[model samples]
Target: MREQIETADRRRLLSRLAGDYHVQTARRAATFMSRDIVTDMTILAITRANVRQITASPEPVAYTYEGVAGVPADGLRIPVSVYALAKDLGLPYENIRRRVKKLLDAGVCITVDGGVVIPGATVVRQSNLDLIAETQIATEKFVAEAGRFGVTAAQHYRPPTADLPKQIIRLAMNYFLDATTFTAKGMKVDVVAVLVLRAINMANISHVTHDPALAVTYAGMEEILPHEARQPTSVYSVGRFLHLPYETARRAVIRLEERGLVQRGPKGLFVSPDVVTRPDVLEGMLYLVALTEAYLKDLARVGIAYRPNPGSPG
Candidate 1:
């Protein structure tokens, strides 16, 4: 018989699932924006603001995921200033201004009377559509994986009349920003450090999630897998994967190691079980769980059904 999914088990599963989804989606966004993950984050911040404006308007037009692409460039896009963006992202004003300038030069964003907006024309592009499609696929995969671990949507839920995909994307962006901000401030690390550590964590457990036996064996283990089960990853590999410069990745890893958040071994690098079990790190994991639960509930509200498995009490 399969084991029950306890709170700890669910937290682990959700963390892994959210980590993978964030990395994949961030990579795609970076590619689409022709910029680094940080810049991509800036763009997401702007887009999130615009999305909010559209959704909050009393206008009669419907805003489905596809329909959003057809909306007028200036219809409901509430321009967000650099100061506001900086505040929202917890980044410096100069940094946000520089990124916004680059985006303006690249035509990825346009300056409006008040501030800037990711234009509808940009959103209608094939590349943007492709990015949205990829996010949709990743979102589906996340839901499926969570279901495998017995985290399913409630049966009585119903889909909302509003734009479900757009709202979900906004929720995801919010989760990413909130999680990044929380981890950076709580752990006394930069965004790059957070990404590097997450990359290492994902690398360490990639195999366990791939193999059926290992997946089942570790599904309820709340702590990190045994050292023998981990697949260590090198700094160079992480740098290449995240499109970060070698020295930048190296420095971040070194800082993480010095902080006792990462471990170095003969093979490569991995997050230590001790680090995973730390009170602060565990709190961050629970924060991630809370955000994920809220996200799932939103999906459930929109009738994206996630049923519990046979004989499982969800």
Candidate 2:
């Protein structure tokens, strides 16, 4: 079993890297990284692709891979001939397999019979072409966003390969869709949403005295906005989104402002500047957004009216 897997992996590398690599070069590329992180990334991709299945596939199980490591919500692998899909995309079939597998291991996609399929989950597939095009589009969207964090795909390579761009975009899509950010404008948040929030927060906290609770809220502001807009970062709008009270909203904003999180400005409130520029800070902010979303969801579940206010945190 191990030999079959290794041989298959090697063959994939040869086919994908054929244009630039000799036989020896192919071997070198295969050894570039261990399979652990690669495997984790694959799992992430499979989980995203099979969003519903990873969650619990509505459809009956076709074939089951027992004791499947990194099995997602569905708990069944949607087997796909990823090599074939790469060919359809006109991508380097060999070059992208490792990446595809990484996604698989990470739970982004599942191996189905004919091809690895992006299951119908949060993302709708109008056509196979739509799926491919959308995936490509998702990749580009993420690259532009990552650039702000100095994590451009180009930075990792000297002259950046074609596969690098595509792979980065794929990874970006994963980072993006993981959020549950819903906007008041009846739209969805994307990379620009994060950037705008980061920038807005940075613009807001320039003058506020720091407080703890407010800091927590503003830190996650990037993930909660209605998209890129020049609006205040007070949770009242978010409270409005969650149908909270003016006091609940007011308290949330004041708390964040006290913590140097909600910076008041000529434009409106938003996150502090330092939160946007620093990656570690930005990550913390992302974590905050996630945490806030979960908390708000709990409030909504039972139709509770827990509106926040502009009260100072005790």
Candidate 3:
């Protein structure tokens, strides 16, 4: 029989897996949205609202990805207002307005009566398709990784009838936002700071999941990874990876270090094991695990049954 992981061990494994997945997805979104992760997030929120509006039906609507992507600009019934955007994103009204204006100027988003909406044409573009495909792959990889640790859906496998890529994307975006918001609030830091910190963590352990030996060793003991196994990464590399400015990355790192969340050495920077095991940080990790579980459950409701690998060590 496979060893059943305790709740605490499950939390640690899921938190790390979720963090890595979201950071990579955000980085890809940033690249697709002209090197601005926030912009991509903003657009995602708007698109989600619009999709909800369009798909509001008393009966089940099996909307395919192509069908939804083909909806005309005028067909977008509900436009997400700037105020709503700001509130949802936990950003200032003026800041959101400015970003909306920039998007309008770039023709990436258009002004409707209530607010702004990304054009259907934009959604159907090659870049957006590539993003969707990449996100799907990432989602699958996350499921597979979780399976290796004996985390699987409670339901039987059932394939989705509709190609609801938009719904999947919306859920993924919500997960990202929830994770970021939870960490930022818990740590008393901003979204950028949360991203910076997560990026650093990802850099340090990016190789663990790929190596079977390392993955098995690190599964429930991530907080106690040996110093030699943890890779030290620089602010410059983190900045480049996240498409953040050098100063922004540097300042975030400094802030983290001041809070005893990170440490700098002769080679580079790394988050120490002690810091990872802090009560507050562990709380955040548990929260992430909860969010991830909810996400998987939602996927099942959407008709995508995720099963753990049967051959995986129990």
Candidate 4:
């Protein structure tokens, strides 16, 4: 019998899984902020504001909308306009206009001089904080499980001692936002539809911890030529996962089918094989791989080898 993972190995695996969780939840958060559901463009707008915060001087700058006074120390405050955000994300003017209106009306965004901004009030709401706190709790549980497995950091590994979870979250948010922008422009598909595709495609690996067999089967399909991972998922499941309306998720999937990005499989819906090899899709894959690799590398600092089990999916 193969030896079980040691303490160090489990720790490393936990780190890698933590990286994966950050990416997944960041994508979910990007799509579903607060009670107000938003389109891809709106997601981009939020990301743009966050990016400003990430790159701002004086680390951990608090972000507040324009005209908001007395910003907190932790706020990475920045103002972003719909037009500029639209141009940056390659979204159409009209579409962004409509979405921005919806976002503002929903109090998820604030408007400023000929532009809009994500406000401190909105960001600091107890609900949002609770969500992040919940994510942290989940991450701790994951690490504890890893410890149980005797996983330890690699001998040469150096763990990031400062705000590691927050760092990972920031990285993940930027990655998914950039990827969505790329897909929207390259595939000529609405960002919302692309988001749906992403969620569907990810259903397989996302469930590995709960259902290892299912994950392996899905992984096997993905490994076969001309076959993508098969996820027989419904709009309700996708919508619930992304916090989108059922109809909205359904329509997005329909749009994806219309655009040939996905197909109706007997299993339900799967990404189209034809599009799997397309340059746009490949480019997106490369981007995702790069991001994950970087995260793994960071995990390696603390003695964790990046050895993933072939029998399981993540």
RMSD of each: 4.1, 22.5, 3.9, 8.0
Ranking by lDDT: 3, 1, 4, 2
**Candidate 2 residue-wise lDDT, 1-314, digit = tens:** 12331333222111111111111111121232222322222333444444344423222223323332222323343554556444323335674587776655754455666556544331221232243344444333322322222222231222223233223323333333233122201122222232233333433332221232332233222322221433354444444332335564455455555545446666456654453445544444335334323322322222211223213221
Stronger candidate by lDDT (1 vs 4): 1
Error of 2 at 57 (Å): 22
The lDDT of each candidate is: 0.73, 0.34, 0.74, 0.53
Stretches of candidate 2 exceeding 4 Å from the true structure: 1-46, 49-124, 127-135, 141-170, 177-199, 202-260, 273-314
lDDT of 3 by residue, 261-312 (tens): 8899899999878888898898888788778877876665554444545334
Error of 1 at 81 (Å): 2.1
Which lDDT value does model 2 have at 47? 41
Error of 4 at 238 (Å): 2.4
Which ten residues in a row are the worst by lDDT in model 3? 57-66
TM-score of 3: 0.85
lDDT tens string, model 4, 41-83?
A: 4654564574564543323323334433223323444567667
Cα lDDT tens digits for candidate 1, 1-314: 01234543655766777777666666667666664877888888888787675554422335433357334446578899999988877778998899899999999899888889988777777877676667666776777777766676655356445455554555567767777778877787877788889888889998776455566666554546877777899999988888878998899999999899999999999997778888889888777767777676666655454665423433
TM-score quality measure for candidate 1: 0.85
Per-residue error (Å), model 1, residue 143? 0.2
2 against 4, candidate with superior TM-score: 4
- Global lDDT for candidate 4? 0.53
For candidate 2, the 10 contiguous residues with the lowest summed lDDT are 14-23
